[model samples]
Target: MSVDAERPAPLMHAWRHPAPKGAAGRCIGARTDLPVDRRKAKRLAHRIRAIARREGLPRAVATSPLARCRDVGRWLRRFGFRHVVDAQLAELDFGRWDGRCWEAIDAAEIAAWSADLVGHAPGGGESVRVLLSRVRAVHARAPAALLVTHGGWLSAAVWLALGEAHAPTAATWPKAPGYGRRVILWRLQAPALHRPSDR
Candidate 1:
């Protein structure tokens, strides 16, 4: 599919939330609600402003309900953009292992997660398929919007958008978009309709 320049572009910019204050090397998933690092939040706010200037303001600023994203949403709200919290944008629930350190988790369970990336739920949390469903739903509802969400959520969305043929192995499928990074994914617009005389 090719994009028609004549039509307004439908763009979705997914910005991974910056690392929350002191949330280093921990299993911080949907259940974890860490606050944004104060210094990092300042930097992120500036970048968001730059993005707004370049993109000419998003249709809406959407974020995961988690504090990491919600804090960023708060910053955006203060900046004058309409912010909305969508649970669909929340990170994958890590269940029992939500806030546990990676080293503290069972090695065998981590291996299980790797063996069946899509189906295995780390600490009995949401599966990859479930996360993808929610992410896709959000995209379908708001094709053109700015989203602040988790790395896991963003990775799943990218993998799904790439389609099954380009699907990667369990070891390589979902990849975290580095904190504070901005990724813009676009869908090509359908061809314009032409009148009989024009054709």
Candidate 2:
């Protein structure tokens, strides 16, 4: 039952389900503002739940408490996830821009934010480094848990796990970095890809 005690510890699979990306300006809105992508949400939930079942997991955990994420976690719970931890999985908060559209962000603001996503919250959000440190601290102590945070957080996590000095605004490792794609899962082995359990 414990990661340390399993015949072969469960492997880490950082799946990326592109979360309704067309809402380019829509992705960072509040819970109530969540898009009505009922069809796509359900479809994504089904796919993720299927993976859990195949991987012999009853439920996958999460990294945030957003309504959209809670909805997905709830969906998985109904499908059969033993639990979905929501406290440690929130996406980086974009403070003042929390509920605005991408089109609304000032070009200079976006530029500044993009240029240095580590030191300041240009968009009034958590920096990549902040996300990385927080996520790493928590995930390091977790088992083979599932994380349903934002694309930024996921990409940063992958970057840190891969031993890169910094995470780029984009993930070049060809991974599932969004809301509807099947990103490759990777274990946090020394090399970041430990062998999966035989069972």
Candidate 3:
């Protein structure tokens, strides 16, 4: 829903899943459902709840269907928060490369993807364009809400929040936040850039 210009802007909290147990240094995308680290998950959840209580509890909580994110979503329930599993929050489907160690992937294919990051569909999976479109659609529906999802999805959302003006250079692109870390984005004062039902 679009926020009113006269009313206060809603708060948004976007959190990345803690590292998956067996997928470190691998391309574990939407095609993988690796288990999460329970200790880290619980610790992050506690910190998230603490932040929500400080910033005003989120109006809603949402997560990707992947277990890594869903596990964290389950923890949010401990504080009496209900969450929705949204397919849009899923990581980019790595297609044939899913679950494969990054070092093992074809170097040429990786270079091609790097060359056309926004349009290339590496391993026959989705493109950056498609991912950002999905993220913007979700934001249009809930301008501000708590989100638990994958690193790629979080990166795309942050890119959109910054305005999709140009591709980031090595120095400009942000480092993905650490596992279980939280990042907040305050929607700008401009008119809602998307329609809730547009997509």
Candidate 4:
């Protein structure tokens, strides 16, 4: 085996940003950029700091540029952690469908996306394949990084970590981690295949 293959994967701890205001029942994506309550953001930041302190992880964090995720990173920065804002960590871009109520979108458009899960770009925005590629790049660049990101991004990371063989259909795609929830992506013994999955 190659040395790179023999090396263990780095650990990554990712937390979904706190739920944004006015996001309930809405198709909030990269373009939405909704705000999260400050208190909730601070609470999550404190939790991250406590975990880092307890586990001896680095005092550094990365977050999406969106307010919901960035707000948490800001709190971490105030607590003395090195904060990095990475656009790659942002949520899937939904294009025209962004920030609209679920019921407002056309059924046929939704079906079209579900039919091609991997290649179809909902709202004419980024495809699932593209999002997976971006997530993989982020992992490759900073395998052990701590992240504050969106649910869709977290789902992609989880899909990659699981070594799934096929692209996820609507039925197989794992649900998004709850807001403010932390998911630890352990380095797999073998490299994971990059495949498409939903946000």
Candidate 5:
């Protein structure tokens, strides 16, 4: 069957940038524009495109509000997914912590909030719940999707999928969005089911 843009299959995929050596963050002074090793971009892109093609995610488009993400989208455009959207997938606007590194951010407040990460941000950023809500909104829009979002976004998605908890860490959030672990395994269902232990 031929893949058509208007009626592509539904799927959610998470892809990470190669690494944060010399990309978006601009922390690295001067290096190749590619977030990942340029020598390997072709190979990586080729591999990703193959998977997308194989999975029938021909419309395997991406959504993100970050320029870096868009830049990555542009790179992957040729893989039959020229459609990349900017959907506020960036880390919750730290509001105050946008540019400051972790060390530069207020430590005492950071420490206070770190104790309970789900509900607070160190420098008045978004809480995990809020972030999950926003990302879930995006998730709700499509039956299948491929988000070029940060690690935090992935973590929340994982939580929503499994209804379980995992350790959150500084490295949890991506400096630049990359391929997320492809594990949106369960089919979407409503909250109407009565659990066996619902007492």
Candidate 6:
């Protein structure tokens, strides 16, 4: 067996941030910084804290810098948890398409992105390949960390965990986990092997 296949997978617990206000029907992305309801953020924070207590996980939580995700992390900080805001955890950047209503974008542009899902940068922003790389970096940094982030970010993590051999088509792409929902992930790929001299 290959070294990577024989290595144990890393573990991660991630939750999708609560739905943001004024985001319905809009193409919210890294550029769209909408606020989430404070109460909802608190509720999610409580859930995360309870999970950590039950699971004996660390008291640190990482979140995307977007307000929707950061708000929950703020509440966790109030509860004495160490909250970190990471830009890498942000959602896919949609460039000009971000914060715009979905109907406003050109259909051809969307189609082009769908055709080259991994390489094409939607709205002239980050591509799926880039997002996957960011997720992989985060996993490599803190594989067992608790995270609060966006649907796109979570989806990227899931794709990497599943081996990510080929680019996913629109039909094959994994759906994002529900808002305020938590998903546990295991990193299946092993860390890069280093030469003995390098080590």
Best candidate per lDDT, number?
4
Candidate-wise lDDT, in order? 0.74, 0.56, 0.75, 0.85, 0.50, 0.84
| Candidate 6 weakest ten by summed lDDT | 190-199
lDDT of 6 by residue, 1-199 (tens): 2225654543778899998999999999999999999999999999999988976889999999999999999999999999999999999999999999999999999999989899999999999989988888888788679899999998777766666556788877778888998767755342222111100
Error of 2 at 131 (Å): 0.8
**For candidate 3, lDDT tens digit of each residue in 1-199?**
5445865555457788888888878998999899888887777677777777876767468999999888877888876778799999999988898999999999999988888887888788988779878877777887668888888887776666566467644345445676776666555223333221110
lDDT of 6 at 98: 96
Question: If candidate 2 were superposed on the true structure by all CA atoms, what would the RMSD be?
Answer: 5.5
Candidate 1 vs candidate 4, lDDT winner: 4
Per residue, candidate 5 scores C-alpha lDDT tens digits across 1-199 of 2334653343356654334344344222111223445534444456556667776665565745554344556557765566567555664556566554556656777676667777775456567767768767776775566555555565556555544345444444323224422333132222211111100
CA displacement after TM-score superposition, residue 28 of candidate 6 (Å): 0.4
Per-model TM against the reference: 0.84, 0.72, 0.84, 0.90, 0.66, 0.89
TM for candidate 2 is 0.72
Candidate 3 to truth, TM: 0.84
In order of lDDT, best first, we have 4, 6, 3, 1, 2, 5
Tens digits of per-residue lDDT, candidate 4, 16-101, equal 99979999899999999899999999999999999889768889999999999999999999999999999999999999999999
The regions of model 2 sitting more than 4 angstroms off are: 1-11, 26-33, 166-176, 184-199
lDDT of 2 by residue, 49-90 (tens): 777777675475563566556666666777766545555466
Q: Whole-model lDDT for model 3 versus the true structure?
A: 0.75
Per-candidate clashes, comma-separated = 0, 19, 0, 0, 12, 0
RMSD of candidate 3 to the true fold? 6.1
RMSD (CA, Å), each prediction: 7.5, 5.5, 6.1, 5.2, 9.0, 7.4
Q: Which parts of model 6 have CA positions greater than 4 angstroms off?
A: 1-10, 188-199
Candidate 3: residue 132 lDDT (0-100): 77
10 residues in a row with least lDDT, candidate 3: 190-199
